[model samples]
Target: MARASPACWPAPACCNADFNEARLERYLVLAHAAGITPVVVLTKADQADPAPYVAAAQGLSQGMAVVALNAKSGDVAALAPWCRAGQTVVLLGSSGVGKSTLANSLSGGTLATGAVREDDAKGRHTTTARYLLPLPQGGWLIDTPGVRELQLTDVADGIDVLFADLIDLAADCRFRDCKHSVEPGCAVQAAIKAGRVDARRLDSWRKLTSEEVTNSQAMVAAKTRAAGKFTKKSAAKRRPN
Candidate 1:
């Protein structure tokens, strides 16, 4: 999964303090769980300092590939490795991060582009539909509308993969079921206190875990409600009255 965001893209601060952090981390978590290779691309690099955003993104997923580019420059050849022949890459990110622009550059399609809101740096939903197109470099590009909210489901494996380093540290904890929070013998916490691991990264891990559980439960509840509705409808239709 290639997760992208603009280097200096503005986001609704009241809605979410760090828009890129929240969105990019969620995508990375989901992608890792699905065994997908995550490439964090910071578009509009030419417009702003891509370093901090790139660092923040890389911190979320160590060893993951990250790219910074000016999408409009049509110089996305850096993404060629993923767009190789017979390979299919899906564009995933919020609106205005340049998925459509990148798709156009790679696939030679004339998709409409939109300007990001000056107030919040949010881009309009330019790519309204999902479509697959042939890449000039011998691959397929699936461009879909920018998602407002990305609710993760059944991504336990991805979490493990994303936080493998922390997981490895957790195994050395004195207790078998260490929560890694306020545990006396928690190696994970030791690493944090020792400046070996960023406290923010640990917080991110915990946050994502909680979100997955919450989302999974919500999905189950939704299905249950839908099933109940169907059952009632079927019973009513079968009634002689």
Candidate 2:
């Protein structure tokens, strides 16, 4: 789950303000949940100044590695640390973010790359499937198709760890289950008012937390139904029919 270098590639002409920060946060949470060291890699650095994007990505987590590089160039030495022997890295980003091109650069293989639309910068699905390739550096690379959406299920610990600062603040609240919304003595709300915490981040935390709970419950219900069906079939078989 280690987020290898290059999580995003800015648009060629200008910085894509439309880049989904929430989606990127979800990816980071997923990596943390899987116990992988997440690194944010900003690709297409040669086209524009990557300082802003780098800062934004770095702000996602304290001390998280953020690297900006021209993936089209064969020199990816900055990523060598994570691409070392015995390690495996995967590229996860939206379509047309140059995941395939980076994979080709890392593996020295000619992976099919698609051109982005001039009007929208959206890319076609050149890579329709996931492929595990051997990098010349002796590590492994998993190149996957662009992800439209990432669903979370049973990842409560990951969400808590990702939002550890908020979690810590919540511990000091008067009520153990304080929702932080209009709840008296809510430490989180106090921090937000004092400008210590970004209100948007708190919103992101609540969204992910609620989504995980809903999805986890759905998964449990599905599993229970499946088990009941299997049990009924076994009982019917035992009836000697």
Candidate 3:
């Protein structure tokens, strides 16, 4: 039961379209859903200047903890505060972001590492399964396979918490159901135009909100169908000769 999860991302020498802000925000939402405080760990800092990557990550949330380091250097002491005794940390990121390497550094385990493609910066799935290893500081680390896609379901509360600022701003809109698009007295839109909020962030919030609603409805429908099938099967068994 880890209370903290470090979401890893590689600080590439050049811009990597694969690892974008939207993807990172999704990870944050997932972490919040799981009641875990996420630490944004930007790996491969030695390959490039980590300042830009660090700043980008920090900008996603207020007072977010971000660490940039060379995971292979075996000097991940900056993460020790979260890896203290009795605590557990899970490594989460896409393939080739140095999750395995970071796991090795923290837990002293020889987890296999892989190389990323020069073209896209994506890597092979080196860690095929999830593992829970003990850290040197008496804590535990859960290393999971790199996730290719993260779908939002049953995380409405988490999303609300992550985007609290936007939620608050939306409350000021003239209409209770204002879509914030071409609506009169739309606080969100006003903020975007006034330079109070980043338009991209507003877009991200909308996308995540829509996705969460759709996925939640689908899940409920699936469960209702499953329950109906089970009830019918029970009725059939009771009516047997």
Residue 236's lDDT in candidate 2: 91
Q: Kindly list the per-residue Cα lDDT of model 3 for residues 152-200, writing each as its tens digit.
A: 9999887987788899999999999999999999999999999988999
- In order of appearance, the predictions have TM-scores of 0.83, 0.90, 0.92
Ranking, TM-score, top scorer first: 3, 2, 1
- What clash pairs does model 3 have? none
Residue-wise lDDT of candidate 2 within 1-241, one digit each (tens)?
A: 4345332221111135435668878888887777676777777777677889877776777787887888888546777777767788878888887888888888888989988887887777899999988888788888888887789998888898779999999999999989999999999999999998889889999999999999999999999999999999999989964
lDDT of 1 by residue, 120-203 (tens): 778889999998888787777788888889877789788888888999999999998999898789999999989989987788
How badly does each model clash, as a count of residue pairs? 3, 1, 0
Q: Sort every candidate by lDDT, greatest first.
A: 3, 2, 1
> Model 1: what TM-score?
0.83
What lDDT score belongs to each candidate, Candidate 1 first? 0.75, 0.79, 0.81
Per-candidate Cα RMSD to the true structure, in Å, reads: 5.5, 3.8, 2.9
